[model samples]
Target: MAMAAARVVVEAEHLLPPGGLAPDAVQTPGPFVDRIVGLGPLGEEYAVVRR
Candidate 1:
């Protein structure tokens, strides 16, 4: 997350959402996919139903 934020700050002076990064800035993908996989079926099965 800090990498994402640094990418934004390098390009813009003001506060920006994590999505505001340039394509090149996001060189490596975040741990999002790995985390989702770790969460497994129970995670997906209940994520929406409970939320």
Candidate 2:
């Protein structure tokens, strides 16, 4: 790990609609994540990413 307090930014195609992400669908676990954001080029969603 680079740093314990390190945070990462993630850009995704779409935000979690309403149902949320399924356990199997999620690539990373929630504890490792810091936060989530919504990014827009044409009104898209953004999220926090970590390793």
User: What TM-scores do the predictions have?
Assistant: 0.22, 0.46
- The model with the greatest TM-score is 2
**Top candidate by lDDT:** 2
Question: For candidate 1, lDDT tens digit of each residue in 1-51?
Answer: 645453422222244466776768654465422321222234555666541
Q: Which ten residues in a row have the lowest lDDT in candidate 2?
A: 42-51
Instruction: Give lDDT tens digits, candidate 2, residues 1-51.
Output: 313658755456678874587888877566666766765565223334331
Q: Residue 13 of model 1: what lDDT?
A: 28
Worst 10 residues of 1 by lDDT: 32-41
